[model samples]
Target: MHIKTKFFGDIELSTEQLWHFPKGIPGFESERKFALLPIEENLMFQVLQSTNDSDIALIVANPYTLVEDYSFDIDDPTIELLDIKQEDDIFVLGVLSLKDPLETSTINLQAPIVFHTSKKVAKQMIINDNKFAVRHIIGSQPSLTKEEA
Candidate 1:
């Protein structure tokens, strides 16, 4: 199906892009439907483009890559929502806020989007981890810009 994307603009999206979020995501209650589009080379980050509204999109990435020690338990309710089964079937992604200089971008650890690929189900889960910050700097930018301000 062809849908308008904020980044790619009028592009064709595969049926798999139609990811269903049973109860919808927080703040985006009405925007339950989203399509995962690649940001760049790294598969770690992608754009959670909303089908309902072209402008309503989010830059999401695998928070685990940023915080390797990151760990959280998925409650039964969430499991039922996404129809999650084996742990391997599930994947986690966190929203990111990009700031100037590229290096200033941060990850939203408080809420992570969990996806059940097999079922094509997704959910934005809010975790209660005191150690986890809603916005945390994972690393400085790559080679070209290594100096921190």
Candidate 2:
């Protein structure tokens, strides 16, 4: 299937590539289906493009890459919903909030998108811990090197 995306423009996707967000991301409850498209020339980021709407794309990355100490627990509800069977079955990603200057960009560490790799199901799970911020500054975080960005 061909989808018209906001960042990547039109691209081909298969049913297997479609991720089913049963509850959808917050503020986008109606947009359930999404595809994680790789951003060419940049391995650190990926585009979470909505198959339903072209304007609903989000730039996402593995929070662990930016914040090495980043850690969160998946609630039982989300585990059951996504049918997460084992530790290796699940992977997490954080949405990136881009700014005019790339260094000022932030990532929403408070809510990480959890995915069940085998099931292809995902949900944006909000962490209740006060240690994380919704707009965690990416540039100031540890482990991000000049080459990585």
Candidate 3:
């Protein structure tokens, strides 16, 4: 299956790489299909490109790499909707917004895109009543990082 993407040009994707979002992401209700493409070999970041819209694409990364203590509970409703069977089946990714210097980039932690890697089903779950924000500074939590001499 060939998909036209914003970041990447025409690319071939296997059916297994296509993710289905029944409810779709917030504001992107009509855009349901997305393909996860690795940015570079062994890189932690990936491009979540929408198959339906050429302009709809987001650079995502595992929040764990940026924030080690990051933790959140997935609502039961989303779990059932996505047909998640076990915790190991899930993979979480955060949308990244790159800015000047790149280190100024922020990730949307309040809403995470959770996927059942085996089933190929995913959903963008919105978190409410949480301390996380849509634009949390990545690698900027000075208090959380320590340096050694």
lDDT winner among the candidates? 2
lDDT of 3 at 2: 84
- The C-alpha local distance difference test score for the whole of candidate 3 amounts to 0.85
Better of 1 and 2 by lDDT: 2
Q: Write the per-residue lDDT of candidate 3 for residues 1-149, one digit (tens) a residue.
A: 98788977899998877999998889899888899888754366789899988899999989888777788999998999998888999999999998876678899999999999888889999888467878988855332212320
lDDT of 1 by residue, 5-112 (tens): 888898888887789887878887888788999855555568999888899889988887788788899988899888777899999999999887767789989888
Candidates' RMSD to native: 4.3, 2.6, 4.7
> In model 1, how large is the Cα lDDT of residue 69?
84
Question: Candidates 2 and 3: which is better by TM-score?
Answer: 2
TM-score of 1: 0.89
User: Candidates' TM-scores?
Assistant: 0.89, 0.91, 0.89
Give the Cα error of residue 35 in candidate 2, in Å. 0.5
Compared with the true structure, all predictions reach lDDT values of 0.83, 0.89, 0.85
User: What is the overall TM-score of model 2 with all chains considered together?
Assistant: 0.91
Task: Estimate the lDDT of model 1.
Answer: 0.83
Rank list by lDDT: 2, 3, 1
Better of 1 and 2 by TM-score: 2
Candidate 2 lDDT over 43-135, as tens digits, reads 777899999899999999899989868888899999999988889998899999988677689999999999899889999998899998999
Q: Return the lDDT, model 3, position 3.
A: 78
**Residue 64 accuracy (lDDT) in model 2:** 90
For this target, which candidate reaches the highest TM-score against the unseen true structure? Answer: 2
Clashing pairs in 2: none
